[model samples]
Target: MTTTALGIREYKRGLTDLGNGAYAWLQPDGGWGWSNAGLVVDGDESLLVDTLFDKYLTAEMLGAMQRAEPAAAEIGWLVNTHSNGDHCNGNELVTGAEIVASKACAEEMAHESPAMMAKLMAHAPEMGEVGEFFLHCFGNFAFEGIEQRPPTRTFEGAFDIRVGDKDVHLQQVGPAHTAGDVLAWVPSERLVYTGDILFIEGHPILWAGPVQNWIDACDYIEGLDPALVVPGHGPITDLRGVRAVRDYLVYIRDEARKRYDAGMPVLEAARDISLADYDSWGDAERIAVNTSVLYKEFAGDHGPNDTQALFAMMAQLHKERRG
Candidate 1:
């Protein structure tokens, strides 16, 4: 019997063509180090939404695109939705493409080189909890020889570019997922590629947040009402997926705020608040990161995040969740 006849729709990996010269490249389970990207083709001109985690993955995605649509062989422009390595590390593979990113993303990209990740992984063996957590989250990707190539062009606020005759609109929607996040909208196709802004089946890590900005970003997506929404991670979804993530952020914000008001410690509050509906989501340990950040926001603290402490907390949380 065919796979579909067996009531199983094979979770195929690779591009899903969205009519009107658009495609979404999906990596299933959308777990750690995995991300989704897109291609917009118009005549012979093509634009890539984002690249994969490392060189090999990006090359693989590009190869698939080339086979499916030759226009992908010559990507004229590459837009990185954010600065996260998972989204931009494969940038060098595109060759001569005028890579573009929001100003904030480009700035963040400067310091978050692939070498940084490699160094961390190298030292993970000696750091106990920190090392274990680091490897757990990022050990899968190969980071060698990744000469980080940041966006050559940068834009602030909203920008639009043309792929052949079609117009692709870009909106800077961050300091939500990170310092610089963006959304790529193909108006003609009513398709939106939201970088880390939306994580469908997994928990989102707010590495940087005022929390409110992310919540607002969600509202912005709802306003667009795109017919097909492709998340930075996860399967293609619609407005409902956008709302799901928004609701989650709101839930954690409100819950953590209540605990903050009661003078509960951030760590305790993180462990205390029940994920309730979200317990089923992958990477639930991310709640530790989310709650601490929300608590910081609630207290009016705008200082740089304590990355080590947050990961330590997450490590502890991971243990608790697993135990």
Candidate 2:
């Protein structure tokens, strides 16, 4: 049977029963359907792994959760897996609850500002159709509405929170995908919410990594053998999904190494490499920047890539692909 795209459908939401008062909202067509946040609730209080990208999106998701397993208002804690706008942007939607995240993620959220995003969007008109098209998909979302509330309670190592009668463990596995990446493990539920650490059937973002650290996270996750692993993006998956990401990492790492050894330029090499195994992965083209980033790490090119340059690189490739 032909597969349906991960979008193009009303985002399916609400909790799937995982036993022990713990449940996860599996967003169908997980690509960009809505932020894949996990919910763990018990008789006394509740805990949210992450929030959606915007108020409208999150509000809808919040309502859905209430419908599936009513009484979400009693939620007491919220944990953001990282600073990526998609994962933590909807903080305002979680009313009356305390928001949480790693210190590094909190710091990264502080680094972004409405003025900066506004400046980027202001030039959208002149960027032509592709630019405007990009804006249309992203610009409608509000950046000004974002209120940067860093995690009130931050921890360097593992932290434990007893959710009513259950034990939910928060592990600090970061500096791999971001400065501070984390995963939520519910012992009783035997489930894991892997933020961007695990991207099933989608192009994994390697923005802040030694790559090997992300690989390590995959290895760590494999050891857990969670029954229902809620990936940062894509459909709910099993351990099989975890292996896909590991294989992608190995594929790209070897491909880039081959090019680097042959003394190929990063950008040109990006276009030339045939990523067949990862071809089905959403935004497979991101392999271009992924290659650039990994090559930079190998060569120690640690110079900062500010917004404009970052935009230019992505925009240029977007234009090329469209043409």
The candidate that wins on lDDT is 1
Which candidate wins on TM-score? Answer: 1
Query: Model 2: which ten-residue window has the lowest total lDDT?
Result: 1-10
Query: Using alpha carbons, what is the TM-score of model 1?
Result: 0.95
TM-score of each: 0.95, 0.88
lDDT of 2 by residue, 1-323 (tens): 01133231223565555555665665545553245888888885788888876666777777867776565765688889888777877776787777777878788778865446656667778887546645844676666656655677787768888887878888888877787899898878678899988887787867777788888889988888776688888777777888888888878888898999899987777777786767666755467667877887788877644435444565666567668
Runs in model 1 with CA error above 4 Å? Answer: 1-11
Per-residue lDDT tens digits for candidate 1, residues 59-117, read 99999999988988889999999999999999999998999999999998887889978
RMSD of 1: 3.1
> How close to the true structure is residue 248 of candidate 1, measured as C-alpha lDDT?
92
lDDT for position 190 in model 2: 71
